[model samples]
Target: MSFDIVERSLNDGTPVELYTFTRSAQVFRYTSADEDVLYQGATFTAVPLSRPSFEQSQDPGRKPISLKASSGLGFVQQYIASPPTDSISLIIRRFHTEDNTTEAVISWMGRVTNVKFESNQVEIQCEPIFTSMKRPGLRRLYQTTCPHLLYGPECKFSKPTFQLDAAVNITGGTTLTAASIGGEADGFYTGGMVEWTNAGVIDKRFILTHTGSGITINLPFEGMVNGDSVRIFPGCDHVLSTCVDKFSNEVNYGGFPFIPTKNPFSGTPIF
Candidate 1:
């Protein structure tokens, strides 16, 4: 048996919930309010697309959901203001009511195709996962995961031993100022990662670039108000020297540090 929740399938599921959602080093989770003690008020209304051709019998695909941002939502407003610095690879899956055991979820993976901000809401359109599968995969090229690029088994990067959290004193405009964070004004925090929580709802992340002045950040955010939570992570340039000197994990370095940049065809031979 199947019922429709916001025009989407609620097929034979005792309880509906997302399994895992990880983006930009942040994961998506629920709160207490649901029967399962989750965020019960949170709703995902399915939106269906209009049928253009009568010749086609089947539906185009599953309707897309418009991302709504309230005063305290997990996904922020500024993210929709502009596309993220890196390409988005969001993976979403839903579990049926009774099949809510383990590894029982559906795929809703897709790429953001269109975004239109409408008065307190960011309506987005995404192409289906089949669109990605239809394209040429990384068959002949060097393939690697994000963990390898950041820090993983092959990268041999060790997480810093110290704390990275900071206390925000002032927040307005694109810059954020902190007073004596972790005992370093702007030295250690430079080039580090900043994970911020806004209004206890959405979480925004930005790479803290050093401005050579005070404890000011380069990236701009929407809800950069005072008293927001911020966590910092030590930066890694991913160079062979940096790996060897700071992390001392050069043995498992994933990059070819000695690869020459000089043109291979620069030399000419005379017969």
Candidate 2:
């Protein structure tokens, strides 16, 4: 029977919903059915997952959906402890059990926004893909300091060239000591970032302070241990001199450093 007829039939309908969450290279699939389901060559494990009725609005502003799942699940626990740096997306599909087929139609598609824990269950909130379009566009600012993000497209600087590779020699809570990275002057790496692998997952943290062979991170890396290799990148102070002396890329500097300090519109003595 066709999915349309099966879906509309009162007694002949058997339905299953599939939920797929993806973050970078990791993909987790789950099904609402009692048993595991295989659709499109991918296995969707049966899990204690449920979602309430969500409105299908015709207006541009859309409401978000919520997925409540057991926190006891391994995948749920991992995401709760340390959320991935990359954006995690969610795809929900419905399958008609009568024919074990779906028209490959996506019921809901969005990205994970927030996760909340209540008792033994986790509630994940997701916003529709078009919700981002409602956000206000960016407007450039007139400031003395560079407004462009480091290593961003406007900065026009390659991150790989400024990165340093080293292995952790000592671990102190949220701090790591790597003698190889100490060759650069103190504070050279402040405001930069560090990336390392932890328990087969790539973890990243911001550099809070850097002095000598010791560097403090903004967050304590979970399961980080000694001898773990890491890559550190240098940070920019966003000053005109630093742009010219350190990176030597003043051509791409986005700051107007020579702006007059005095109010030009006011009736005052000209410099």
- On TM-score, the leading prediction is 2
lDDT by residue for model 2 (1-271), tens: 6788787899987788989988766788999999998888899999999998766568422668888899886556656656666578888888865664545457888898888889989998889887878875776778888988889999999999888989886566778888877898999899889988665557788899999988888877666678878989888889989889888889999999998898877987774
Q: lDDT of each model, Cα atoms only?
A: 0.47, 0.82
Q: Write one digit per residue (lDDT tens) for candidate 1, span 108-196.
A: 55555555666655554555556655675543322221224554456655555534565665544545555546354334545556666
Clash pairs (backbone) in predicted model 2: none
Give stretches of model 2 more than 4 Å off: 59-61, 198-201, 265-271
Q: Estimate candidate 1's RMSD in Å.
A: 8.6
C-alpha RMSD values across all candidates: 8.6, 2.3
